[model samples]
Target: MRTVESRNWYEKSFGEDYLLVYKHRNQHEADRFVQRVIEWLELPSGSRILDLCCGAGRHALGLANAGYRVTGVDLSSVLLQKAKEADSSGCVRWVEADMRALPQDGTLTNSFDAVVNLFTSFGYFETDREQLDVLKQIWMALKPGGRFVLDVLNAGYVQDHLVPFSQRKENGVVISESRVIQNGFVIKEIKVEEGGSRPRFYTERVKLYSPQDMENMLKETGFLLDVMSGSYDGEAYDERRSPRMIMLGHRNL
Candidate 1:
């Protein structure tokens, strides 16, 4: 099975370097993203949830506060530490692990009622097989009747309005953005300006995926494709106009 060998640019870009910046400006947006998922899932109170790629435990803890028993998993120790610190209700369980291959015999194998791959966390793999492997891992972790919700970007729409380059800075950090023409992926170059220290820069890349491609992957993993929308508001997906693509699938019982 193909696995992601090293920590990708995101782990570094969003690690200790950019966490504060994200928390300051982008945190509310993250929360809003989770709220959208919660609404779409319509999960009940105390629902068993596994949040894959649960960064900083924002979504996982948010769901827990709403009364869901949430277990969050990620590969970043620093982010997971922040997650553990922010988990006050004891409702959220934080695990540091790879999403492609989870601890099956450990805490996560076939052990959740709902598995979430939110905020466009589905397409980081360098190849199609690796991406499929990640889906299979998610498939195995869910209970027979479990559900999986994915919030991903609409590649077609993104390419249409694709910004070739942009820049933004806040909270003592500056972010330069660019796109890779080869794959039409977005790359963000972040630089932190600290006193008496040289500026540091890290990069993050996310592949743009089509709805049909994602649905096929889910079906290949034995999940039944349930819903697909363009945005968080339950609108129809136009592929050319929608800013976001959100999909919900279920594992066969």
Candidate 2:
């Protein structure tokens, strides 16, 4: 008999391959996004910020460079290592923790002045209740009236514009991806081939939640939805057209 390992796709897919797959998400873009978030939050210079699901610490490092106290938490130790390498200044604190459990020894409760979860990091859980639990944890980690920014794929726009197949080559690696929508989730199958190495396969799936769904979740989780934008540039959200759904909310006092 063979032992079977049971884990979500996210647990296996976010290892070393993920770094190469997403290497194009550079610091310049993160800096720009952090600037927009700072402007939107209007918090003090030394405010403590939590970059939840802060893969590779791009945005967290950017925030630290901009003079905010930043703590970045991600589930991938491999990515966290990369983040630590990039953060030579030792400015941002990086922690390996799942978003569903960010208690951090009770120190994280009501700790952050602002929390930012960018790049469509939400909606990975298997159940709606679990997704809501993540939001509740975010709310608990924030101080009264503290702000949060969530950036996710616009469900309507993605439904309308999803590309079924795409291929690209980067740094001697050929990567191919196929996507499909099923049962309220966007599922992507990825294949990577480098030189004579055996091909690697990975799958990524995220629940496709509409803006209204997110709004209601925030409200139910004790956050006041303040603004919804279509992009990092702060354009208003359009259900049929927006490429990204960026939302700003505050912990209800």
Candidate 3:
């Protein structure tokens, strides 16, 4: 008898389909966001930055273009290939690695001046310990007085604004999504259908953690929470109204 293999949705969902689905996340917007990040970091130009889970190197390349040395790490080989193709200037270094085991070696320990994990990249792990482990790795990778910026969906806003079902057409493909909150996780079931082709199905599961939870976790991992913004524009965070929770933390000097 054959046993079914158990794999995480993240391992399979972030291939070519993901790129196509999220193609509209353009470089211009990424650059704009990076500008905000640069101002928030308040670090000198040319400081070393790591873009963890840097899918397609959008933000990574943006940071590189803005005069910072950037290393982009992601688990998706396909996305990394796209990032390489787009990185004509060779400004950003791309690495294929999991967030849970970042750098995967001692060569990069305490190397980066700032690390940015954007677009809700955290909370993929099944357990709280595993989720916290990712933060620990980020802490270990930063030098003393280094900074970190994490962008994630606001759990309160998500709970209030979640639509059960939505459908749209993009580039001749019909994309349908069904979302439900289960066991403190927002689970999305995506279906994509192209004309005269079999429909493809994908799942995305992200654990929901409140802003306070994030602050506590970062503090416990040796980061001093500095700023918590509601959006990319540097507005103050509001648990009841913020669309995104953008946290800035600093390692103790």
In terms of TM-score, which candidate is strongest? 2
Residue pairs in collision within model 1: none
TM-score of each: 0.89, 0.96, 0.96
1-253: candidate 3 lDDT, tens digit per residue: 3234377789889998897777778898888899999999988889999899999988999899888989999999999999999999899989899888876577568999999999989989899899889898888888999999999989999999999999888898998999999999999988889999888878899999987798888888889998899998888999979999999988886
lDDT of 1 at 164: 73
Residue-level lDDT of model 1, residues 64-128, one tens digit each, is 87778889999889989888888765668888888888886657878888898877677776788
State model 2's lDDT: 0.91
Model 3 root-mean-square deviation: 2.2
> Which residue pairs in candidate 3 have backbone atoms (N, alpha carbon, C) closer than 3 angstroms, thus clashing?
none
Regions of model 1 farther than 4 Å from truth:
1-7, 24-28
Tens digits of per-residue lDDT for model 2, 76-161:
99899999999998999898999998856977889999999999899888899989988988998999999999999899999999
Give me the runs in candidate 2 sitting further than 4 Å from their true place. Answer: 1-5
